[model samples]
Target: MYIDGKWKAGNSDFAVTNPATGEVIGRVPDANEHDIEAAVAAADIAFADWKKTTAYQRSELLYRAWELMVRQKSQLAELMTREQGKPLKASLNEVQYGADFLLWFAEEAKRMYGQIIPSARENQRFLVHKSPVGVVGAITPWNYPISMITRKLAPALAAGCTVILKPAESTPLCARAMMEIFDEAGFPPGVINLLTVQNPSRVGEVFCTDPRVRKLTFTGSTQVGKELNGLAATNMKRVSMELGGHAPAIVFPDADPVHAAKGLSLVKFLNTGQACISPNRIFVHEDHAEPFIQELTSRASRLKAGNGLENGIGIGPLINELAVGKVDGQVKDAISRGAKVHTGGQRLTEKGLSGGYFYAPTVLSGVTEPMRIYREETFGPIAPVITYRSEKDVIAMANDTEYGLAAYIYSNDIGTAMRAFEALDFGIIGINDINPTSAAAPFGGLKNSGLGREGAQEGIEEYLETKLGGFAI
Candidate 1:
C-alpha cells in the first residue's frame, strides 16, 4: 500500500486471487484502522499545499500522468484482466478510458471558473471562488477498477484536493499498478494515498466520520451507498455517489431489429453485465419481440467464453463464486416463476474451464414484472426480455424501479424517440446508442441510484466548494 507519500507494506497482508481461475495472483496489505488514519492524515497534510499550487502546475502533473499511463497501458490492462476477469481488449479500453479522464480533466483544471455576481450596492461586487473541499475519501469497486479509480482521482486532483483511495479487495493489483504510475509521474508526496483492505465498511466508517476528510466519493451498490451517505451526514462531509442501476433498453416495433439487438447485446453483457450502467431489462414491442429474441439468443450463443487473456474470447467469467451463484440463483428463480429460458441459463461446467467461475450468456423470455430478475438488479450475463403492447405501458414499466441511472430507446421515429427521451426518468438516456458514457459527458444517477455525478465539468465540481467574496474595488 502507498500512503503518506510513500510505498510501504502493511502489518498484515491479504491475498488477491484471480476470479476466473481462483488462483492467488498477488497479495495486498490489509489496512487496519491505524493505516486508514495514517492515509487520511497524509491526505489532510497534502491538501494545503496541493490546493495552493497553481492550476497550471496541477494540470501539467495530470498531463504527465496521462502520458505515463498511455505508455504503460498494456501492463495496466493485463493487470485489470488478471484481477477483474474482463477480456483483454475490454481491459485495454478501460485503461484508455481511465487515461482520457486524466487528459480531459488536466485541461479542465485550468478552466475551473468562478462567477462574478451582480451586487445590490454600487460600490460592492460579489465574487464566488471555487476551492478544494479538502481531503477526499474515495472508495471504488472491483468492476472496472482502473477506470473507477481514475474517474474519482482525476477530478479530485484537478480540483486540487488530495485523496485517500480504498480499492476493492477483489482487484487490488490494478490500483497498485496505477499508484506505481502516479509515483513515476512525480506527483508530490501525500497527494494521493492507496489503502487496500478487505473490510470496506470499517474503513468507510473511519474515513467518513473523520474530521480530516471533507469529501467522500464512492462507487458501489445502492445499499452501501445509503450507509455511506448517512455516515458522511454526521460530519456534514460532501458526498458524491455513483451507485447501482437496473437500466432499461426499450426496442420499438419500427426500429431495425438486427441493429437494436446488436446494440442492446453489447451493453447488456459488457463487463459480463457487471457495470452499473449495463442495461438489465429489455422492453420490445410485441410485434418485434420474437425476431429480436431469436437474434439476441443467436448472438449470445456465438459468444465464446474463456480466459480474458486469451484471444477471441468474447465473454469472460463472473468475478467470483459468489457472483456466479447469485446469477445462477436468479436464473433458477426466474425459471420457477414461468420465465422461458431461450438459451444458456446455467453455469458452464465444461472440462478445462471448470476451475474458473464461468457462466454462459443467458436470455429469458415471457418474463413478467413480478419475477426477481424483472425488477431487481441481476448484475451478471443474464438479460430478461419483456414484451409490451403499448408505449405508455412500456414507459411506465421503465420508470417503475427505484433505480434511474440510465435508459435506452431504439426507435426510427424522431417523435417517438423524443417522447421516450423526455418521459423516461433516468440520468443518462441513449437513443440507438448502447455505449453512452464518455469522459466528455456527465455520468451519474437519480433517486436511490446515487447522488451527484462523475465525468465532465460536473465531476470536478463535487470536489470543490464555492465561497462568495464581496469588496469595493
Candidate 2:
C-alpha cells in the first residue's frame, strides 16, 4: 500500500488470491484505523498545496499519468484479469477505459469555469466559484477495479483534491498498479494514497466521519452506500455514490431481433455479468419474445468460458466461491419459483475448471415478478426474459425494481423509443443503443441505485464545493 507519499506496509497482512486457481498471488497490508488516520492527515496536508496548483499543471500531470497507463496497459490489464477474473480483452478495455477518464478529465480540468451572477445592488458584483472539496475518501469495488478507481480518482484529482483510495481486498493488485503509474507520472507525495484492508466498514467509518475528508465517493452496493451517506453526514462531507443496479433491457416488436439479440448478449454477459450496468432483466414484446429468446439462447450457449488470459475465451469465472454460491442460490430460487431454464443453468465442474469458480452463462425464461431473478440482482451471467404485451406494461415492469441505475429500450420507431425512454425510471437510459453511459456522459442512478454521478462534467463537480463571493464594485 502507498501512504503518506511512500510505499509502506502495515503490521498485519491480507492475502490476494486468484479466483480461478484459488492460489494466493500476493499479500496486501491490512491497514488499521491508525493507518487510515495517517493517510487522511497526509491528504489534508497535501490538499493545501495540490489545490493551489494551476489547472493546467494538474492537467499536464494527469496527461502524463494517462501516457504512463497506456505504456503499461498490457501489464495492468493482466493484473486486472488475474485478480478480477475478467477476460483479458475486457481487462484491457477496462485499462483503456480508465485511462480515457484521465485524459478526458485532463481536458475538463482546464474547463472548470465559474459563472458570474448578477447582483441586485448596482455596486455589487457576485460570482460563484467551484473549489476543491478538500481531501476525498474514494471507496471502489473489486469488479472493474481499475476502471472504478479511475472514475473516482480522475475527477477528484482533476478537481484539485487529494484522495485516499480504499480498493476492495479481493483485488488490490490493480489499485497498486495504478498507484505505480501515478508515482511514475511524478504526482506530489500525499496527492494520492492507497490502503488495502479486509474490513471495509471500519475503513469507511474512519474515512467518512473524519473532518479531514471533505468528500466521500464510493461504488458498491446500495446498502453500503446508505451507511456511508449517513456517516458522511456527521461532518456534512460531500458524498457521491455509484451503487448497485438491476438494469432492464426492453425489446420492442419492431426492433431487429438479431441485432438486439447480439447487443443484449454482450450487455448480459459482459465480465460474466458482474458489471453493475449489465442488463439483468429483459422485457420482450410478446410478438417477438420467442424468436428473441431463441437467438439469445443460441448466442449464450456458444460462449466459451475458460481462463480469461487465454485467447478466444468469451467469458471467465466469478471472482470467488462466494460469488458463485450467490449466483447459484439466485438461479435455484428462480427455478423453484417456476422460472424455466433455457440453457446453461449449472456450475461448470470439468477437470481443471472444477478448481475455479466457474458457472455457465444461464438463460431463464417464463420469469414472473415474484421470482428471485425478477426482483433481485442476480449479478451473474443469468439472463431472464419477461414477456410483455403493451408498452405501458413493459415500462412498468422495467421500473418495478428498487434499483434504477440503467434501462435499455430497443425500437426502430423514434416515438416509441422516446416514450420508453421517458417512461423508464432510470438515471441512464439507452434507446436502440447498447452503449448508453460513456466517459463523456454522467453515469449514476435513481432511488436505491445510488447518489451523484461518475463521468463527464458531473464527475468533477462531485469532488468540488461551490462558494459564492460578493464584492462592492
- Quantify all predictions' global Cα lDDT against the true fold: 0.91, 0.89
RMSD to the true structure for each prediction, in A, is 0.9, 1.0
The TM-score values for the models, in the order shown, are 0.99, 0.98
In Å, residue 19's CA in model 1 sits off its true spot by 1.2
Candidate 2 lDDT, 39-115, residue by residue in tens? 98889999889999999999999999999999999999999888988899998988999999999999999988998
What TM-score does prediction 1 earn? 0.99
Residue pairs with backbone overlap in model 2: none
For lDDT, the strongest prediction is 1
Candidate 1 lDDT over residue span 281-311, tens digit each: 9999999988899999999988888889998
